[model samples]
Target: MSPRTGVRLVTIFSAVVLAFFLFGDWLARRDAPEPLAWYETYRESLWQPIQDRSLTLLQADQALGRGHLWMISADGEPALVSRYNLESDDRLWQAQAVIGLGAEEMESLVEAQAWEPGIRDQPVSPAVGEALGDRQILRMSMIPVEPLELNRIEGTFGSPDVRMPVSEGEAWVYPRAGAVVAVGEEEAFSIMFGLRDES
Candidate 1:
């Protein structure tokens, strides 16, 4: 074969191999399931709990599925909280729910040996589970695996009701919706849902 012909054949073979790999990559990506978006998860899993005054652990489980429950003191108040690692497109986002317990429920949980300091894997006693089942969820928070685009926050929730300057960024509060979004220069870093005192 002529040198020029051999060179042309080699170039054609390389181009074909490159195109085959590119097409395979595209196919694999297209077939893979896309991870849930933060906004969608908020609307679906968190919105109802925040809106209803009577949401409970049982109801939350029905909405968000069973998660890892822990005994905690939130804002100096004894509370039970559950955390779930939510799968997202980029990474696992964290969802937390804080459940407020009454005096009686707290006593029951204490007696049931539910509170283990610094340990989250302790098996929940029947009494502890019963006590937590009916308690109200005071707040819910979603921490994205990656920072959220600033425009996405504004687009979903509209402008903030209050904006406070912080060391890293600004905190945008939407009291009516019971939401707080901590925004950095380019993106939002955190989102919380619960009632906040205006003052």
Candidate 2:
């Protein structure tokens, strides 16, 4: 009402607004996430061990070249990601070919062929079969065989109790882990190492 009272109230309001802005700015700067090195990123932490091992094997055999590495977000956390071009990368194909199968055992895959049973039967190589059997799911970066090939793999495992879409692909889920393959014209590949639950 009074000029003096109005002036006092305006002064108080200005100071409060100034303080609020200053505090907010300070808090934002303090809580900002720090930039991480390639190895320290979340994707790296999750996938680096496999990448390093693969690289080492390639290096030891004198076939190592520039390997691919990139960053991705996993469950809202920063993560490092890498994938091998299965159809193109000879070294990777060789390494993955030998992951759990011997040379003869690897050749056994030729005998395994996708067949259609009452439900449907997909044939998988012994190496793929063994990896599928042991790990129950491939790692995130492993190349996906063709869908027909994958379907046969799933058929070998029996139909998934529950199948659902994750992102742009479908996931054939099992009890312990889930198999997700991205199917699209642009990206028609499967991650042999399916996405696992962090829980």
Clashes of 2: 10
Q: What is the lDDT of residue 134 in candidate 2?
A: 26
Error of 2 at 186 (Å): 16
What TM-score, computed on C-alpha atoms, does each candidate reach?
Answer: 0.63, 0.30
Score each candidate by Cα lDDT. 0.72, 0.39
Candidate 2 structure lDDT: 0.39
Clashing pairs for predicted structure model 1, backbone only: none
Give the TM-score (vs. native) of candidate 1. Answer: 0.63
Question: Mind giving the per-residue lDDT tens digits that candidate 1 earns over 43-100?
Answer: 6456655655666777777776777776665544455678778776566678788877
